[model samples]
Target: MMIPLAPATIAAPFARYSHGVEVPAGWRLAVCSGQLGMASDGTVPESPREQADCCFANIAAILAEAQMTLTDIVRINAYVTDRAHMQGYMDSRDAHVGTPPPASTLMIVSGFTRPEFKVEIEVIAAAP
Candidate 1:
């Protein structure tokens, strides 16, 4: 399980977010490369939300390939071209993760491998 690390004083106020913490022991760790919004047939979606969905879907598929789920993710690195769409992506992510969300870093980049593509996501998972 992902444990939030923080002193009692610091963590009380920021209970919504986990304190800097450590990954549990004996868990299988997997580092996934940045997944673009390309479909299985190499089609990139035009909408940012669509792309973000596709990217996360691709990530989920990859994690499943290794017998993992989103709950096993400890960290997520998200790259998006538009800031307006970031919240949507986060919402989608929350929908996927449900509870005990992973630590995530969201970035706004200038462009991507495909101009139509709007988001890419990379993840690190620790399986218990």
Candidate 2:
């Protein structure tokens, strides 16, 4: 099992995520490419929350190909086009991640390749 690290010397995480995670030896790792908010049907949602949901769904599918699931995720890197979309992204993340939540970071970017895209997510997972 992975170990969550939250040092007492530091402040608690600002959101539903761990500050770090320790993947044990002998576990296999999967690094997924960043996933955009577009659905397989080639449609992008107008709302940030919806877009983020799509992004996580895509990530889940990618992990499934490797015989893993969202609970195996150890880290997440996410980007949003605007600060206003942060809450929306966070909500989706909280819904999908497993207990003791993975270490995470969210950033605001100028934009994506597509103007309509509001969120993108990538993750690192490990499983024995």
Q: Which candidate leads the pack in TM-score? A: 2
In candidate 2 the C-alpha lDDT for residue 38 amounts to: 92
How many clashing residue pairs, candidate 1? 0
State the C-alpha lDDT per candidate.
0.75, 0.95
- lDDT score at residue 118, model 1, on the 0-100 scale: 79
Identify the candidate with maximal lDDT.
2
Per-residue lDDT over 3-31 for candidate 2, one digit per residue giving the tens place of the 0 to 100 score? 99999999999999999999999999999
Off by over 4 Å in 1: 6-21
| Cα deviation of 93, candidate 2, in Å | 0.1
Question: Model 1, range 1-128, lDDT digits (tens) per residue?
Answer: 78756576653522222434468778888899998878888887777677777877888888998899877778888898888878767766776662466767788999886687778889888877
- When superposed on Cα atoms, how far off is each prediction in RMSD? 2.7, 0.6
The number of clashing residue pairs in each candidate reads 0, 0
